[model samples]
Target: MRLAWRGPTMLVTDVRGELGRGVTSTGLWFRETRYLRTMRLLVNGRAPHLCALGGQDARTLDLVYVHPELEQFGGGGSGLARSEESLASDGLPHRSIDVRVSHAVQLDGLESRYVVANRSRRVARLVIDVALDCDWADIGDTIGDREAPVRIWARAVCDGSSLELRSTHPQLRYVTHVEAPGASAHQSGVRWTLELAPRDEVVLPLRVRAIDFEDALTGEGIAAREDALARWRASHVVVDTTGHGVEPLVIAAALEDLASLPLLEGRPREWLAPQAGLPIYPALFGRDALTTGWQASCVDGGAMLDAALARLGRLQCTRDDPRIDAQPGRIPQQVRRGPRARLGDGAFAVSYADVASPLMYVISLAQLFALRGDEALIRPHLDTARRILDWAHEQAQGGFLHYHTRSSDGPEHQGWKDSGGAMVHADGSSARSPIAACEIQGYWFAAQELLALVLWMLGRRGDARALWDSARDLKRRFHRAFWMEDESFYGLGIDREGRLLRSVTSNVGHCIASGIVAQPVIERVVERMFAPDLWSGWGFRTLSSAHPAYEPLSYHCGSVWSVESTTIALGLRRFGLDRRALQLADATLALASLYPGFRVPECVGGYAKDEMPHPGAYPRADLIQAWNVSAIPGLLHAMMGFFNVAPLDLLTIDPILPTCLDRVRVKGLRVGRGVIDLDVWRDRDGRSHFDVTRREGTLHVVRQPPPESISVGIAGRVRALVEGLLPS
Candidate 1:
C-alpha cells in the first residue's frame, strides 16, 4: 500500500517498486479537510482530466496564489515567499505547469499488463523530462526552514512502449520559472513514447538524488530560495523504493477510483452580480435580494464550523516558543502584528505582542475538543495546553490576565484589538501599562467553563467541579469589575486600578460569548447591544456611533466584522435569543451580499439607518479572508437551528429559516452516524417541515423533536435521546 500525507501547502507523491512486479491500481486518500478543495494528482494516473480528480477546482485553490509579499518565517528573509528563486520571481519569469497524469504500468515476465487506465476521450502522451537550462536547485539549509532532502537516480522501461524522459540539472526550486536549460541531459536512448488508448494503461520508471547540504547564501535571495527548495524536497522523499513496478499501476488505479466517486454537488446558479464596483464589500451587496442568497446556501452550518475548528486545529502551534515558555498551551492572541512587529513563525504562538492568552487558547481548544468528542486528537498538545492554563491561573491580576510575556521579544498588550490607542481611560484617554482588556477577561471565564466541560467529558469528576468553581469566581469578578451601572452596558476595558473603560461596543458580546453571564445580566447586555444606540440599520457596529471616538471605517472602533457578529449570534443563541440571532444572521447576510463575493469583508463601515441607505465599504479590506467567510455559514447554522441529536443515532432538525426562504435542500450531508440527504422547506402556511433520509447507515428514525428555540438543561441528555433512536 502507498502512504500519503496532505499538508496545507503541498501534496507529495513517492513512487516505489522495481521494473517488474504484480500490477496494482492506485488509490487516493485524504482527511476531507474543507479548505483544500481539490486533489492535484502528479505522476502517472489513470484519469486524464482534472474534473475526475476530486477536491477544489483550480479557481477556488486559495493557497496556490499566495500573497506576494515575502514575510520572514524563521529569521532574516526566511518567510513564506522568502527564497532565492522566489526573489527572482519578484519581477522575473514564472511558470505554471498543468500536469495531466494519464496512466502507468509494470512489466511482469513480458505480459504487459495495465496499471493506470487512461480515462480521457483521446489517447495521451506525456513528455516527462528534467531540463538543465532552466533555473532549478535542490533546496537545502536556510533560515525558517524544516525538513531534509534525499538523493538517488533510477530509470523505468516498459518492454513494448516508447516513453522518453531526461533530468539534466538535478537541482530543484519551489518556484518554477521559464528559462533556457543551461545543459541538456546526455541520454543514450532515443525519445520514448507510450501510446495510451482511451482507458488504456502505461508504466514509467522513477529516480531521485536526495542528499544533505550545508547552508549557503550565494545571493541576496539565495538563502531564502534554498530554504523553500529544501522544504519541498523534504516532503517528497521516497522512503522505500524497492517494490517492483507492479505498485505503480495499483496507485494509478486508486487515483482513478477517487476520480470516479460521485460527489455531492451544490445546485449551480449565478450567485455573484455586477454592482457599482466601487469597492470589494459594497460590490458584493449591490446584487439581488440578500435574504434569498442566504436561504439558498444555508445547509450544514454546524459542519462548516466543525470543519473550521478542525482546520484551525491543524494550524495549531505544534512547535514551542521561548516567549511564552511559562505558559505554553495558550494560543496567540493575534496571528499578525501591527507595523514592525515580528510575527511568530510557528503555527501557534503563545503570546500576542508580549501578553499571554492562555485562557483564550484553552477555552477554544476545550470547546472544540468537547464538540468533536475526540480526546486523542488533542492529546498531543495536552501538555502544553495544561501548562498554559496553569500559568494563566497564577497570572490572574485583579480578575484579568495582564503583565505577562506574549512574544519572543517581550511582553506587550494582549487583547483582541491591542492597537496603540485602543486601551483608553474612562475619560476617553489612553491607559497606562498592565491594562486588562475586557475581552481577555471574557475569554478567561469562557476558557474555565469550557475546560470544566472537557474535564467532565474525560470523566474527571473532581477536576471538572474544581474548574467550574474557578469559572464561577471569574464570572463574579468580571461582573463586579466590568459592569457599568449607569450605562447598563459592560465596559470595554479596565485599567490596573479596575476602572471601567466604558464603551458601548460589541466587546460586551465577548462577555456573553463566554457563557458565564447570569440570566439577568444577559438580558441587560443583550438589550444594550441590540438597542438603537449600539445597533445600526445594517448590523451591530464594533463601537456605537454615539461614542466620541466612533469612526465608521475604524478597524476596532465602529466597523462591522462578520466573524464578531457570528460569534455574538452564537452567544445569543445559547442565551435563548434565537430570534435576535436569526435577525443578526439576516442582517449579516444582507451586508455580505453587498460585497463582491458571497464571502464577507474583514470589516465594513457601520453606517446608520439614515446616514446611508447601505453600509459603506472599508477602504482596505481583504477579499478572501478565511474567518470572515467561515462566519457566514456559521451564522446560518445558528439561524437554521441545526444540531446533532448525538448518542441517539438520529438527527433532529428544527428549521428556524426566515419566512423569506421557501425551500432549502442539503444533499449528501455527512452527520453523526452516516450520510443523510436533508430537505427543509417552509410551506405557504408558514409551517416548517424537515425530511431526512439515510444514505449510508442503518435507518434510525427518532420522532422526538429538538428544542425549537433553546436547549436549557439539555447538555449530555440530548446525546442519549439521539442514540436511543438509532437502529440497535
Candidate 2:
C-alpha cells in the first residue's frame, strides 16, 4: 500500500493513486476511522492507462496516465517501459492524450491536481469522473474483530458545484467536503466534461477535506503544506549516497516516514511528538516512541526523543490501576483515543503493561541529555525518572526484575516481543508470568546505569549512588540467572518460579545493545546469535528455529523484526563487532530493499535469505511503521560508531562502510550547541575514509572506538575505574 499522510489523517491507496470500495486498506482515514473509502477516477467512462506511478514519498504522489479511450499502447504484459514500446497492438490508436495527476496531503485535507494534455495534432474531448464513497468503519472495524456498535452511512449533498459528505455515528460526527470548483456534482460522485484544442491542456483540481468535528482539525499548515514538506526535508541531514542503490532508498524511505510522524490534532502543541505510525498505530506509544526517538537520534539529534519524553512525562501514570497495570510514574504502553478506546470498551485507552517503557523512557531521556548537553530539557523529567526507578525497585524486590500482567485485557507479554506465545519454553509451553526477559533486564540495567550518571551530574549524588548500586546488583544477578553456560547465550527470560525458559533467542545479541552483558561473554553471545537456528541470514529471528514453538510467520516466535535487528546491530557495534554489525546492517537493508518502497514492515517471516528472494510478508504488519522506519538510520549510526556525551563534551565518530555503500554524505548533524556535516566514503580500492566538512560547536569530535567498559569484562572495568583510567 502507498500512502500520503498529514499527522493523524492518511490517504492509503493502490500504487495507481486510486481508492475504491472493497479494496484492501484503501481509504482516507482520520484518527482511527476510515472516512472516505472509494475514489475511482475514470476518463471517458473508461479506466485510464497508467503510464507511471511514483508513490515513494509519504506526503505526495505523482501519477502519469494516458486516456485509455483516446490513446492506445501496445503489449498486454510486457516488462519494458511503455515509453519505448511500439503502439501497434490493434493499429486503432488515435491522437495521444496524457493525464497527469499530482496528489498532495494537506494538514486538513487532500488535494488532487490533474492536468490533461492533448499532445497530438487533433482536438480532444474528455470527460473525467471521480466517483467517491465513505465507509464509517474505524481502524478496529477495518483491521480487527471489533464491530462498530452503530453503523452510520454517509449522506451526500450536492450543490451542482461541490459535494459534501457527512456521517453521524452514535458517539461522533465526521465531515468530508469535496470541492471541485468547475465540476458538476452527481448522486455519489463528481464529474467534469471539457474540450481542449491540440497542444493545449486544462487544469482540474479536486480537494478533499475531513473535519472530524470532535477534536477540531488544527488546520495546521493547510495553506503551506507543500512548503512545510520542503522545509522538513531541508531540516534533517540528507544522506547523499555516492554510487549506491539500496542504501539511498532505505535512508530516504525512513526519513520520509519520520518526517510525516509529527501529530496534528491531539495534544498541546508544546510537547507534540510524532505519533507511532499511520492507519494503525497513529498514537503516542511508550515503547515505540522512545525506541523510535533513540533509533533516529543519530540523524535528528534526539529531538523527537526529547519531545516524546516530555509528552510521556506529562502523561505518566499517576496512581495504581490494576486493570491497566498502572502505577505512579509508570509510563503508559500506548495512549489511544479512538471511539472505542475513548469509551473504554475494547482496546485500552491508556495502558501500562509495557514493563520496559519506563526503563526505555529513562534511557531515552538520558540519551537525549547526552546529545543536547542542555540539562534543562531533561531536568524537568528528573522526578518522573526517579519515581520510575522507585517503581522498578519495587517490582524487582520479590521477582528479580520482571513483569506480570495485571489486566486480562492488556498484553500478555510486555516487552517488544509481546506476542502471546513469545515467552514459550523449549517444550512449547507458556512460561509463567512475571517473566524476566533478558531484554527487559538489559533495559533496566542500562537505565539504572545511565540515569545514575545523569543524577550525579545534576548534583544528586546520593540518588546516583543508589542507582549505581541497583544497576551493579542487577547486572550480577542477571548474569548469574539468565546466562546459560552450556550454550554461551543468555536465556530468553526466567519464569515466575525461577525456571529458565531454555529457548535460544535473539535477546542475547539484543542484550549486547543494552551494554548489560559482561565483557567476557561477548564472543559467545555473538557466536550463538549467528547460529543457523537464530540468524535467518536476512536478519536475526526473534526465536530460534529449533524451538517447537518457532514459526517463521509467527508474531514473535520466529519473525525477523527490523527494529530487533537494529538493536542487535547497535549492540554488536557497541562492543566493536564491526564486521558482524555490518553484516547484520547489510542484511537488514538488503531485505528492506526487497519490500515495497524500501520501507520495512513491522516484521517479516524468518526465512533464510537464500530461501526467499523477496521478504516474506508478515500478515497484517504495519507497512509504514515508525519502529521499522528508524532501522535505517539506526543501523547506519551503528556502522558509523557515532556516540555523543554532551556532559563530557565528547562526540565520537568511527565509521565503517559496507560494500553496498560506496560513499555517504551526511549534512545537518546536531551536536551540543553545534551542528556538523561529515562524509564517509570508500576509496576505489575499498578503503574507508571519514571527513568532517563542517564543525560549528565546542563539542570535541574524537575519532576513537567505544569505551572499553561497554563490552569489556566487568571486573576489568571495575579495576580500571579504581585505577582512575575513566569511569565505565
Candidate 3:
C-alpha cells in the first residue's frame, strides 16, 4: 500500500493517488518546500473502492479503483466523467466499472489523468470530485523529527476550470496553478461529471505547475516526459543476460534506473549529470556522484561523469569559510538549490565538511581519465585537484587525516557512516571530535597514489613522485595508527585523544579496495570480513553484529548498504579472492530479488540470512539511490576483471566468471570515442573466456593491467611492463 513514483523535481503522493492520504511522505515537493499538498478523488461523494496499483516506468504512477455502485446521473447530478467481476467489486457481476488514475510526474509539476472505463454491458455515469490544496513544508517537517519549520498554508482562489494557490510568509512566497477540462472549481477543488457509452472510456487530465519555477534547474524544461521509459531501455548500455537467473534482471533494472535518474526526456537519449536520488537527495552529492561515476564510467556513464566532475570543480570551495566548513580546494558534500538553501536556512544547503569527498573527487578524475584517456576532460580540474591534495596534506597531522566540525549545522561525523554514534568504540563509547576513520585513510591513500599516476602520464614526473612518496609514507603509518593486532584487523578510527576506536567494522574492507591493506594482514582482514559477526550472509554489515551499539535497522550502524557491499566485493576481487567477491555479489543480487523493481534500496536490515523471512526494510531507505544503481556496473565489471586504462589505449580483461552468470554480453561500453561489445562466459571446466564480439576503435585490448609501473621514465615502460593484480 506504500507505493510512490519519482521524477525530476517530483511527486511523492501515495497509492491512493492523493497527497496526505495514508502517508505523510506524500506530496509535490521540490528542493526544500512542498508545493502542492492536498489532492483526493471522490466518486459519488465517498472514496471509491481501491483495487490495484501498478506502473512499468519509474516516473509513471497508476492506480485502478472500482466504482461498484455507479448510478446514472441527470442534469441535477452534474460532476466528473465515468470497473469489475462478481467477486471483484460489490456490484453485480455484469455491472462493474473501473477508474484508473494515471500520473506523469514531471520537473515543474505533475499531471493526473483519470481514465474511467465502463466494463459492464450497460452505460455508466459517475461524479468525480478532485480536492486540491497547497501547503509549504520543508523536508524536515515531513521527516517528523522536530527539525522542520512550520508549514505554510496557502489561500486558494477558484475559477471555472482553474484553481490558483498562493502562500507568502516571512521566508518566501510560493504559488502553483491547477487546471482541468470542464472542471467547475469550487472553494478549494474541482468537480466533473461524465456519461460513457457501454465499454467506452473517458480521459480527463488535470495539470499542476509551480509559478515562476524553472524546470531546467533539475531536468529538461519539457513537462510531458513522454519518452523517458523508452530511453531508459534503449539508451547507453544494453546488457543482455542469457542464463543468469534473476541477476540479469537486476542488472537491466540498474541500468534503467541510472539512465532515468536525471529524468530527461530528450532524444538520442543523452544521459546528463544527475542528482543523488529520488524523494530525498535530489541534488548533486560530491561523494555519491564521484564514487558512483567512477563505477559507471567503465560501462556507459562517460559523457555525464565528466560533466559532474566539472560541476564539482566549479562548486569547489575557493576560500576558507568555517560557517559551512568550506576549506580552500575542498569539494562540497552536497549542493542544494531550494530557497531555504539560498536564504541560509537549510542545514545541508551546501555542506562541505565531509572528509572523503575531496579524495573521492580526485580519485574519480583519475579513474575517469584512465577510461576516457582524454586529457582535456580532466585538464580544467587539475588546479582544483592539486589544491584538494594540498588541503589533504595540510589537514594531515602526525601522518593521519582527521575531520572536525565547529559549525552548528555541520555534520557530527564526517565519514560515510555519519549517523549519530556511528563512530562508536567497541565498548559503546562515542569517538570524540576530530576523528580519523579507517576508510578516510584508505581513500586518502588511493587519492594520492592514483592522482600521482595521472600526473606522471601528464608529464609531471617530479610532482607525481612526491605524491607517491607521501602515499607510501601514509600506508606505513596507517597500519601503525589504526591496526588492532589482537583482532587481526584495522581499528575503526582514531579519536582526538589518539585512542583507536577499535571496532571490527567493514571499514577495513574499504582499505582492501584502496590497496592499502598490508599483505601480512590481508588473510586476517578477509577472515574477519567473513567472520559470522561481520558477514550478514545478505551482504557486509557496516558494523559487526557483535558490536555493542549494533542495530539491524540503524542507518549506518549496522544496515547492509548496497553500495557498501559492492565496494567490499570489489576489494575482495582485488585481493585475488574472486570466489569471495562473486559470493558477495550473488548474495547482494539475491537480496535485490526481494526488493521492488529488482533494484536495491539505499540500505536494508543487517539481519543474518536466517534471522527473518526477509531483510527488514530500513525506515528511511531510498529505493532509487544513484550509488545503489551504479553498483550493478561495478559488480559486473569486477566479475570480468575488466580494467580500462585508456591513457595507454589499453583495456585489460582477466575474467573469472561466476556460475550464476552463464553468458553476459555488454554492448555500448565506451572507451573514449569507441564502443565495445564483449562476451564473457564460464566453461564447465571452470575456465573463463571472453571474446570481443565487436570493437569500433583504435583500442588495444589486452589481458593484463595498464603499464603503470614505469619506475624510471616513460621509455622504461617496456622494461617495467608487468603490472600486478593490485589496484593502481
Candidate 4:
C-alpha cells in the first residue's frame, strides 16, 4: 500500500512510512525536481510491522505500526522476573508496544511526528534511526527512464542537532534541511534511544524543509497551514445536495481537489495557476489549465478563466524556435520552474508541443466573456487573441489544421490523446507526421467562431465577418474530408499523404460538441457514438473497441477519459440529444463514485460495461487530475441545460434531468452582475418544473420552449443581441 500528500508540491511514501524505494517515482518533488530520493526508518535494526494507514485530509497521513511480539517480550528472558512472569503466564506478552507516525505536508516543507507507547506490565527500551539521501534528478529524466547527468552532486553537512543535504547542478540548486530536537546527527541520519515504563509514551517531532534559493523558512506551524487551507476552501462556491446518495460527496470532493491544486506561491506571477495533477504533473500545463478553468466557470463565476487567460497571454510564444517547438502566438504546452529546466539550448521552461492549447485559450476566454459581460477584463488581451487566431489561419492553409512536432524531444502527437501510438490506421500502424486530428479541426472551428463573436462585440464588423467566413469554410471542408460515409461515423484523422486514418474514436464526439459537424450528420454521429463499439458503459472510449488498435489499458488508444466524455455530453445537449446526454452524464458520475475518494482520474481503462463491474484503472493515470475533477460541474451544467450570454442580459434554461436525480437545486450560481438560485424538480407525472427562487440583477430568463420550437438560429440571435449591447 502507498500513501501520498500534496500541497504546493507532492510527497509519496510506501507502506513502511518510508520513501526509500529508489524507484524513479517515490520521493519529495518541487517544481519538477526530485528533492529527497530515499528516506527510511529502522527500529532496533529492523523495520516495524505495519498495522494501518489512512489520511485525514489531502495533506496529512497517519500510520500505525508495532514491533514483533517476540521482540516486545524482551528476547528470551529465562527467569521471567515477577510481573513479567505473571504476564507471560496469563498468555500476554511481557510488554505491549505501539508506534504511530503522522506526516503533515505544507507549501514549503514537511513535518513528521512519531509516538512510541508501552502498554504492558514491564518497561521497554528501543532504538530508532532515520536514513536519508538525495539524487537531485529531474522529474522528466525520471519519468522518461533516462539517466541524470554526472555533473549533479550532493553534499551533507551537520550543525549540532540539525543536518542539511544540498544538491547542485548547472541548472538547479536544491537543499533539504532536517531538524530533530533531542536526537543526535550522524552519517546515516539521526538516532534516538528511549526507555519507557509501563503505560508510558514519548513523542518525537521532526521537520524537513525544501528551501527555495532566495527564501528563508518562516517556521510557520500546522495551525497556520490549516488556516490557510480553510480560507482557500471558503473562496469557492459552496454546494449541497439533498436526498441524493453520492451527489453531495462528489461535489464536496471536487471542490476540495480544486482548492488543493492551486500553486500557492513561487509562481511566475502572484496570481494562482492550477497544477495539472498530483504525484506526477504538479506543474502548469496549458491544455489542462484551460479545460479545467472552462469547466469550472459556473462555480467560480469565470474567475479561473480570467486568471488563465492572463497567465497564458504572458507566456505566449513570441518567436519561432524549432528546438522547443515554440512558434509566435502559441501557448506553452507545459511550464516548469527548476534548475534542470534551463539545461536545454532553447528556452525549455516553456515547450509548445500542444497544438490545441492556443485554441483552448481562445475558447476559455469566450466562455468567460459569455459568463460575465466584462469587456474591461478581456479588452486588454484582444491583441493576444488575434495573434493566436492569425496563427491558426496560417496553419490551416491546406484547408485543415495539422501538426508535426518540430522539436526532436517534443511529443510525437500534439492533441489531447498525445501518446506515441495514439494516431494509428485501421491496421494498427502509426500515422505519419503532420497529421490533422479530428478534434483539432473542431477546436479550430469553435475558436474562430468565438473570436468572431468577440470582434462583433468590439464593433469590428470587417474582422468579425472574415473570421466567421473562415470558420464556415473550415466546417465545410471538415465535413467533406473527415466524414466516413460508408461507416456512418467520422474518421480519427487524415494522415500526411491526405488519406483518412480510418479509425473510429471519441474525437468525433468533440466535433459534434464543437458544432463543427453538419447538422444533417449530427444525429448519425450521435447514434454511432452511443452504439456498443464506442460507449463503454463507464464513459466514451478514446478509440472504438472494434478498431484493431484498441487496447483497454493503453494510454490513449483505448481509455475512458472523463474530460472527453463531459465534452461529448455537452455537445449532445447542444444538439438536443437530451436522453443520450443524460445517459452519458449519469455514467460519468457513476464512474466517479467508483474511485477511491470520489475524485475522478485523468483516464480509466476502456472496458465494456456489462463485461466489467467497474472501469479498470489506467496504470499511470493522475489520480486527482484538474480537468477530470471539473467533470462534476460540467456534468451538472449539461444536465440542467444552463447557458448564459451575460453581456446580452439573457439566461436560458432547458432542463433535461435524468430520472435518477428527481430534484436538483443550484444555489449561489453567479452570472453577469448577480447571483441566481434555481430549483428544478420532477412531478409525479414525470414532467419537469423550474423555479427561480432567487434572482438578483436585471437578467432576462428565457425558458426554452420544446425541441421543435427552438429556432435554428438561436445561437446567432444570442450573439447578435450581445453585439447590440455594445455602444455603436
Candidate 5:
C-alpha cells in the first residue's frame, strides 16, 4: 500500500522506507536543519536566540554572524562564522512567565497549575527547564588569582486572596523589600490568591530574566573573596515540566548520543566514480561507504523515484494562453504566469521569463518521463508537452527562437541564470535583445527531441518523425549560424542582426551536451573545456581561465556552477567521451567536498584549489539548493549508463563503475514493466558487470549491447532473449 506521487520537481512519499515515511539517518536529520525557515519555531519565536556551547572553540562559535537582511536561503549571516552581536539580535519575540503563589511553602502537599494558549496557527509544544549555576567561577581569573565569593538572598509575602511570592532558598538574604497587599504582609512566607480577567483565554508564559538579590557583605567591606561573595551569590535554576512531545528535543537527544560514540568509517559518494567531476553514487541506496552516515534505506529507490516523479508532474504546466476562449489541450504552456503588471490595455499579463520557465519544466518533465517510461504519467502530460513544442516553434524567426509576444518583458536574459548581469556580447559587452542565447536553444532542441521520442513511443510515428525533422532542421541551422570559425567554438549568442557574440564559455559546452552540435563540434568543445587553462582542480569556470574577462570570483564570469558543470559532464558522455566524462564527475565530487560543510552550494568560486586552497563562497548561495542536490543523483545515472526504451517495459543498465567503487547495489528500481534489483560491481580486471533481477512485473531484457560504447554485463537466462532483439 506504499504510494508515492511525483511532482514536477518534488517527491512526496507515503511509503515506509524513505525520508518522511519510515527511514532515518543522521545525514537526513541535517536536511531539516539546513534551511532556516523550515523550522517554524526558529523564525517566529519571542526573544529568539541561537545557542551553541558544546564542542568547538569559542572562536569557532564566534564565526557565526547574521546579515541585516534575509537572503534567498533564509539565512542572514555575514561570513561563515558566528558573532555575539549577531547572536544577540538573532531571533523573534518571546513569551513572558510569572509565578503566582497563595502561600509560602511550609506544607508539602501544595498544588500549582499553569494555563497556556497558542496565539499562532502553527503548532508548537512548550518546553520549560530551569538551571542553577551555583558555582560561578571564571577559569581565567581563578587560574591566576584567589577564588571568587558569592551569596544569595530574597523575600516573599502572600495574601489569602492575592498572589504571593517567596524565597525558595534559606540562604537568600533580602536586599530590598516591597510592601505586600494585606496588613498581614511581612513574613518569611505568606499566603495569597490571584484573580484573572479572561477566564478562558489567559495562558502561562515562560520567562527567563535576570533578578536582583541581596549581597552578603561584612561591615569591613574588604576587597577579598568574602567581599566578592558579599556582592554575588548563587544563580538559581528553574526547571519546567512542560517540554513534552517535541520531536526536536527527542531528535537532538538522539544526535547527542550518536555524537558521543566514536566516529564511524565510511566511503565518500565519489567512490563509485565521477560524473562531470562529481561523485556517482547510486540513486536510492548509495555506496555503503558513502551512505553509511546518510539515510539511504528509507524507501525503495523505485518508490522514491515514483514519488518525486509524481510531485514534479503535478507542478508540470502545459498549454500556453490561446487568443480567446480557446480549447484546453495537453501541450506544455507556451507562456505561464509570471510577475504580472497592468498593461496599457488595462489588464495584467504574464512576463516572458515566466513563460519560458514552463518550457524548461516541460522539457525536464518529458525527459524524466521518457526515462521512467510510465505510460500513465506520460498519457496525462504528453499531448500538452507536444503542443508546447508546436507553440514555441511559431515564435521562431531568423534561424532562432525569439521571445513571443507573451514575452512583453522582452528577452532580458530568460534562462535559469536570469540575473541582469548574465548576458554578454562577443567583445565582453552586454548584448541587445530580440536574441536567443545558446543554452535556451539547446533546451528547445532537447524539448523537441523529447516530445518526438514520446510521440514515437506512443505509436505516433509520423508525428514523431515530423518533430524530429524539425529538431534536425534547427540543429543544422544552429550549427551553421552559431559556429565561430576562428575560435573553433560556438558563439554564446546571436541576435536578429545576424551578428555573432562568440565567447568560449560554459554555455558553448552546454550546446555540445544537448546533442545539438554535430560530432565535430562536440569534440572541439570537450577538448577546450578540459584544458588546464580553463579547468580548475574543482570545476570548469563559467568563463575559461584564458579569457581576457575571466575573473575567478565572478558569479557568471568565472565561478563554477553545479548545474552548468553537470550539463557539461552529460555532454561529454553524449559525445562518447566516457573516460573524460568520468573524470569531470569525479572532480566535481571533490569540489563539492571543498564546501566547508559537506552540504551542497549553488555555485563555488572558480579559483583553483591551489589559488584559493578552499572553496570560495558565492555570495548569497542558497544553502539547501535543489538543483545542486539533484545533480548528484543525475550524475550517478549518467555514469551508471541507465536509460529506458520508452513505451516498451524495458530498462538497459550498462554500468561503467570506476575501479574505486568496489560494488554498488540498487533495490526497488522501477522500470516501465516492473521493479528490479540492480547490482553492479567492478571486477579486478577493471571491467564492470551488472546483474538485474526482476522482482515484479514482466521484463524482456535485450542482451545486445546498445549502439553506444558503454560496458554492461547481463545475468540470467533472460539476458540472451533480450540480446537477440533489434533496435538496441
Candidate 6:
C-alpha cells in the first residue's frame, strides 16, 4: 500500500515506510527537490512484517508491524527453543512483538512516534535501527527514467541526543536533523536497545528537520508546527451540509487538501497560490490554479481567485524568448523555485507551453468580478487583461488559436493533454505541431466574450465592441473549419497546413460550454458524448476507445480525468441536457468515493464499467490533484446553476437537483456583501422546490422558470400570517 501526506511540503512512502525503492516514487520533497530518498526501520537486523497501514488525517500516517517468529531468528540454545515451543502450545509466540509507527510530516520537518510492545511472557532483548540516506536529486529526474547528474556525499555527526546528517552537492546543500530521546548514536544510524519485561512497552520519539544550508536552524517543536497547520485550516471557507450522504465529508476533505497545497514562500507577489499537486508538482501551475480558484469562488468568496489572478498577472511574460517559449503577455505555464532549478539545464525557473493559461486567466478574472463587485480590485488589472487580449488576437491567424513550442525542452502537445502522442491523426500518427486544438479555440472564444463584458462594465464600450466582433468572427470560422460532417462531430484539431486532424475526442465538448457551437450541432455533440466508445460509465475518456492509439491506462490517451468530466457536465447543462449532466456528476462522485478520504486523483483508467466494477488507478497519477478535487463544487454548480451578478446586487439560482439527491441545504453561502441560507428538496411528485430560509442585507434572490415573483418582505409577512407560503 502507498500513503502520502502533504503540508507545505510532502512525503510519500510505501507500506514498509520506505522511500524510493524498485520503481516506487516515494520520497521526502521540498521546493522541487528530493531532500531524503531513503528512510527505513529495522528490528533485530530484519524488516518487520506490516499488518496494517493508514492515516488519521491528511497530514499524519500510521503503520503497524509485527516481529517474525522466534524460530526464524535461529534459537541460540535448547532452553530458548523449549520456551518458544511451550509458548506456541499456549497460543502465544514466546518472543514475538508488535510495533506501531506514527508519522506527522509538517511544512518544515517530520515527527515520528514509535511504540514497541513485547507480547510474549519471556523478557526479550531487541535492537531498533533507523537507516537514513539522501540523494538530493532534482524532481525532474524522477518524472521520467532520467538519473540525477549530481552526486551527494553525506556526513553524519552525533551531538548528544541529536544526530545531524548533512548532504552536500555541487548545486545544493541541506541537512536532516534527527532527535531521539534515550537513544544512542551509532556509526550507521541512531540505535535503541531495550530489555523488556513480559507484556511491557517502550515509546520512542524521533524528530527530523530539513533545513537549507544557508539558513540558521531554529528549535521549533512539533506542537508549534501543528498549531500553524490548525490556523491555516481555520482560515478556509466552511461548507455546511444537511440531508446528505458523504457529500459534506467529501467537500471537507477536498478543502483540507487544497489548504495544504498553498506555497510556503517564494511565490509571485508573496500571495498564497496553490500548487498543482503533491510530490511531483508542488509548484505553481497557471491553468490548474485558475480552474481551482474558479470552482472554489462560491465557498471562498473569491479570495483564492483574486490571489491567483494577481500572481499570474505579475508573472506575465513581457518579451519573447525562444529557449523557454516565453511570449509577450503569455502567462507562465509553471514556475520552479529552488537552488537546483538553474538555466542551461532542462529545468528552467519559468517556462511556457500551452496558450490556454492566458485565456483561462481572463475567464477567471471575469468570474471574480461577477462574484464581488470590487471595482478597485479589478480596475487595476484591466491593462494586463487588454495586453493578453492583444497577444491572443495576434495568435489567431487563419481564424483559430494555434500553438507550437519553440523550446526543445518544452511540451509538444501544448494543451491540457500535454503527453506525447496525445494529438494524433486518424491513422494514429502524431499530429504535426502548430496545431490548433478544439478546446483552445473554445477557451479563446470564451475569453474574448467575457473580457468584452468586463470592458463594457468599465465604460469602455469601444474596446468591448471590437472584442465582441472578434469573438463573432472566430465563432463563424470555427464552425466552418472544425465540424466534421462524416464523423458527425468536431475534429480534435487542425494541423499546420489547416488540414483537419479528424480524430474524435473529448476536446470538442468544451465548445458546448463556451457557447461557440450552434444550437443545431449541440444534440449531435451530446449524442456522441454518451456513445460507448467515449463514455466509460465512470467519466468521459480523454480519447475515444475506438481510436487506434487508445490505451486505457495511458496518461492522456484513453483515461478519465475528473476535471474534463466537470467541464463536459457543465456543457451538458448549458444545452439543457439535464439528465446527461446529472448522470456524469453521479458517476464522478461514485469514483471519488472509492478512494481513501474521498479524494479524487488526477486521472484514472478508462476501463468500461462492465469490464471493471470500480475505476482502475492510473500509475504515476498525482493523488491529490487540485482541479480534480474541484469537481465536487463544479457538480454542485451544474445542479443549482448559481451565479452572483454583483453589479445588479442579485443572486440568481436556477436549481435542477439530480434525482439521486433528495434534499440539500447550504448555509452561510457568501455572495457579495451578504450571506444567504438555501434549502432545496424534491417532492414525491418528482418536482424540485427551494426556499431561502435566511437572508441578510438587501441582496435579492432570483429563481428561474416561472413562479410568481414575490418580494422578500411581503413573502415573510405572508409566511407569518398564513400557512407556509404556497408552493409555486
Estimate every model's Cα lDDT from 0 to 1: 0.43, 0.77, 0.75, 0.76, 0.42, 0.75
* Candidate 4 to truth, TM: 0.89
| Per-residue lDDT of candidate 4, residues 205-300 (tens digit) | 888888766443355533454465465456566565543568557767886776666654432331455777866677888988888888877777
Lowest summed lDDT window (length 10), candidate 2 = 86-95
Q: List the residue pairs that clash in candidate 4.
A: 171-339, 172-339
lDDT of 1 by residue, 1-728 (tens): 12121111112111321110121111111111111111222222221222222223211111111112232344444444433344213231121113323221100001111133344445455333321111111111100122212222223222222312222324321111111122122222212234556556544322111111221112333234334323432322121111223322222222222111111111111111111111111111101111112211223212222222232223334445556433333433332111112123331222334332345446545644533345665565455556656767766676577653334554344566644555665455666556777777777777677777777777888988987898888778777877887888788777767666887877778677667665566777787888876788667787777777777887777787667787787678666676676677667666665544354556778887678876766664644333454455456456545544323444445455554455555554444445566556666676556566436664244423334324444654475355434443
Candidate 3 has which clashing residue pairs, if any?
Answer: 79-192, 79-193, 80-192, 80-193, 80-194, 81-194, 83-96, 83-97, 83-98
Q: Choose 1 or 6, whichever is better by lDDT.
A: 6
| Positional deviation of residue 488's Cα in model 6 after best superposition, in angstroms | 3.4
Which is superior by TM-score, 2 or 6?
2
Worst 10-residue lDDT window, candidate 1:
105-114
lDDT, candidate 2, 436-497, per-residue tens:
88888889899999999888888899989998997898888888888889988888888888
Backbone clashes, each candidate: 70, 1, 9, 2, 84, 0
When summed lDDT is taken over every stretch of 10 residues in candidate 4, the lowest stretch is 719-728
* Deviation in Å, model 1, residue 713 alpha carbon: 11
RMSD of each: 17.5, 4.8, 6.1, 5.2, 21.3, 5.3
* Arranged by lDDT, best first: 2, 4, 3, 6, 1, 5
lDDT of 3 at 386: 93
lDDT (10s digit) by residue, model 5, range 523-601 = 6767777776667877777777776667777778778876566667666665557778777766766655554334456
Candidate 1 achieves a global lDDT of 0.43
Once fitted onto the true fold, the runs of candidate 1 whose alpha carbons sit more than 4 angstroms away are 1-176, 179-326, 333-360, 369-371, 403-412, 645-652, 685-687, 695-728
